[model samples]
Target: MSLLDSWTRDLHEAEDGTIRPTYRKGTGPGVIVIHELPGLTPAVIDFADEVVEAGFTVVLPHFFGHPEARSNPGTLTGALVQVCTSSEFTKLATGVTAPLADWLRSLARTLHAELGGPGVGALGMCFTGGFALATMVDESVAAAVVAQPSVPFAIGKKRAADLNLSPADTDAVVARAAAGCQVLGLRYRKDRATGTRFDTLRELLGDNFVGVEFEGKGHATLTEHRQQEAVDRVLEFFEEKLKG
Candidate 1:
């Protein structure tokens, strides 16, 4: 049997008419777990399954790649090419939110409406990490987790410090942070892929930004590297924010 056999597959249409397949499972409060590059691999699915076991409904959206494909150099290259070339993502552009964030926000609203809680949770990893922060502009998302956000290629000083948000969206996120909405971020201290945006998050969100930095060189704290402590922290955050 496939790893996704338990998930109920469905199509979600965004406000801009973008349709994507989403796999869902579990019950209780809702959480949208966006996968890293190379699509929804087994590791990502396992993390999502943990979220379900933690007593929250989880949705895994299929953004790219063959679902359940293992992450390898070839798959990573293919997904990187797709992400770099796709018009939906903002890759190397600073101060601009990816157009794909609109779809994610739409999905958050749909989940919030379906579950009827304070709001839903959004977690994005690797290539899609900052997308979680982008979704926070909407009130429908209460708990946002950014795990190793890498965007704009982090090729330069400006791009490295950028939060992957437009001016308007940045202002909105700042306001939300000031209003007591906390954003949880996890990454390896020396992971260059994550860039210096965590510093920017600290500057912008101040104490509202909760960062969990590991002491080694590794990426994908909740997946590829798979730190149990980080996983526990994320679940604790979800329970406090979503269930409290």
Candidate 2:
């Protein structure tokens, strides 16, 4: 089915310069979905539609500036912007996931206040896997799903696997996961961008983290291959932890 046909909706979200074009739908409870670095594409919106179908209200925030990005797949996105002109990419690539951290927290808080104060779930992928975990610093967020998460700029270097999270922030989030919050991650075994990231989360979150590893797939699998399965599993993870 076409993405438009799949995610039937009348959107209620408005635009913000600080945030990429966003869309919200569904009713009862809340879940915030952050797009990957290339911005909110058709496949990404389709993910949101599926999550909304699962029953939680979904908000898909455009992480990169592809503000009007289409929902269909196979568009080539520029991963790195010239640091001199594009500060957002610079901030993200340099490990300053602070903007992301703050946005998720704020969005969660607002949803709780306006939407009966029920717990909120968060999902971030690739350039944003760590986002859901870090947002737990707020405590109001009940669950998170991190898919194909990687430290910033891992795509740039061929060698040297880095966690991409600030040492202090990673430590803090680890403590949250240890205490009570549930964190889940998904990745293909061969995707190097997320390999180091998954390794780091394993060290920090230990058994508290649930990882869904695909056998032969890689980075695109999360957004492409078996997407129905991906959305279902993530929704289950959220419901398991967030629902009363």
Candidate 3:
């Protein structure tokens, strides 16, 4: 519930005029933190701070374009009601993650060259969970940790990230797993929105997947009541897998 005093935070703009706010702290390895559907909120910021405390450089790249949004009923109604009602919303949702995937890949390389390398690790949740994995394809990512990845459950809103990845793409990630790179993910036992996405990932990863199924826990509660536990486990996982 507290922001790490030592962390450095700023908003960076891409060449495309997209503004991305990122928070970073600590030294040694790097870990990119991607948020849920709600975008950059206090909760996601908390997650970033905790990752810094865990002893890695935590970069939370704000890709939502809409700054610091919350998904409370009223706020979501105001922002999304118009878009959702529009003809483009459905199609937009399906392919929204593609540009983001590209952004992360580019950022990963930038983090390596500009911030210095050994590459980086990742942590993504809800809508953006699979993004870490997508970034790994760029070779600048050494590890990934995803939780409750949603959009790709049936069909990724973005055409490129479509839930239906081709065999070649799937093989590349599988090879990454085999190559000593590590990827982990989590889910609640009761999250209906995520549906069976976690299940599919589990089967795909087999022994390589660091799967943690919360007991009696739903999606929201996974990061809510057990924030410290989640942070600790994820940090340890990154340190072990990525640092190794």
Q: Highest lDDT among the candidates is held by which one?
A: 1
lDDT of 1 by residue, 46-161 (tens): 99999999999999999888899999999999998888788999888899999999999999999999998889999999889999999989999999999999987789899999
Lowest lDDT block of 10, candidate 2: 6-15
Give lDDT tens digits, candidate 3, residues 111-167.
766655557887777756767777777777888887766654443323323432345
The lDDT, on a scale of 0 to 1, for candidate 3 is 0.64
Which number leads on TM-score? 1
Candidate 2 residue-wise lDDT, 1-244, digit = tens = 5444433333232224344345677886788887775666677776777777777888776555454455343333454342224543323344455454665677777777677553788887776676777677777788888888765656554212444456677676778788878788888887777646666667778898887788765674446554556666888887777676
Per-candidate local distance difference test: 0.93, 0.66, 0.64
Clashes of each: 1, 2, 6
Off-target runs (Cα >4 Å) in candidate 1 are: none
The true-structure Cα RMSD of candidate 1 reads: 0.7
TM-score of each: 0.99, 0.79, 0.77
- Candidate 2, pairs of clashing residues: 42-71, 151-164
